[model samples]
Target: MRRCGPAAYPQPIRRCASCADGDRSLRTVTGIFLALGIGAATGLGLTAASVGRGTGAGVLHIGPWLATPKAGTTEADPYARAVTARLGTLPLALADGLALTAEADDGGQRLDGRCTYRVSGQMPPARFWTLGVVGEDYEPAAPAGQRRAFTSYEVLRQADLPIDVVIAATARPGNWLPSGGAAQIRLILRLYDTPIATTISTSTGLPAITRVACS
Candidate 1:
């Protein structure tokens, strides 16, 4: 009876409101992804910058000269000059009494320690040793989540035995160290006052990094 103005011309036209909404949602999602990408890039950039400023990455030596420190010498009286002179060469072997292998991969001198320290040798009888994660600045790194620095001296033990120290994180109070699958760690094997001691000569060995992780 009555004719609609535009509808009467030909066919009916349906409104695409849902389609418009979908487009808007897509735009919102794209914006979110972009923001996330930017944040990730910024974080990576900071990490790289920090690494550059630290000793985490540098020319690596498999081992250093003079493996052990003097038995009676104290930290106050360091043998720095004597140690520096010895590190001129590379892959320095521990004296006959000791054995050590760089747990890190050769040519992988980022100072990112990802492997377990395998120290196999006759440890000194009366001496106590420790291994700790130190920063490239030669200080203790900040506490990381779920894991702390592991050392043989810190381990809660009942009886003394031949020391086979593996520096890793652990929650339980026992001999075993729980590695948190960290990206890196400095496997510092230390020997206290003993007849046959192995010392990481000052200004030698591997450098340290600040950002340490358990996993």
Candidate 2:
């Protein structure tokens, strides 16, 4: 056998100390970039979620309902403005009306679409009002297609009695706003030309959501 020192083959095997160090450096750089990309994505996701669901820390907290009274005006908070822009919501003016969002029932349970709910009680003083399940909050477009609402004018009511609205996927007796078979849903109460628009302090009261049954 012939004695061979370093050059055994024709080409030189480049496994020097510097080469190992360079490979380690490349790996470190790649890991850092990957970390940065993941962090960026996470941050953006959090921001979108935050904008989609405004926190109660900055807006009104009426039991389970939440709202930004000044969201339609220039005086709206930055977060509210961001939310409005993202949702593409044309909120009613502060002088015209106010909108309240309810994500949970009176028992502090998240409003599930598969279950039936009863919205009862007197509404704030307003010239006109509407109650319906909106698309954004939990966006219920799964089991139902036609999006509809119950208006104060058309909703069946007895002689000056408190109204009872039913939220369910199937048909109901009186006032029925479709909830579809969605996993979750949001109830929006819009009062047009309401006293609560101006005097939110004496906001009469909001409706109560009680879970009736589940399918």
All-Cα superposition RMSD per candidate: 15.7, 4.8
lDDT of each: 0.41, 0.80
How does candidate 2 fare on TM-score? 0.73
Off-target runs (Cα >4 Å) in candidate 1 are: 1-111, 114-122, 142-153, 156-160, 164-184, 197-215
Question: Which residue pairs clash in candidate 1?
Answer: 68-199, 136-208, 136-209, 169-178, 180-214
lDDT of 2 by residue, 54-144 (tens): 6623477788888788888888877777767775778789888998888889888988888999998877888999887854443543344
For candidate 2, the clash count comes to: 0
> In lDDT terms, which candidate is top?
2
As a whole number from 0 to 100, the lDDT of residue 101 in candidate 1 is 23
> What does candidate 1's lDDT look like per residue over 58-111, in tens digits?
222334212323212343122322332333312222232222223342334433
- lDDT for residue 133 in candidate 1, whole number 0-100: 50
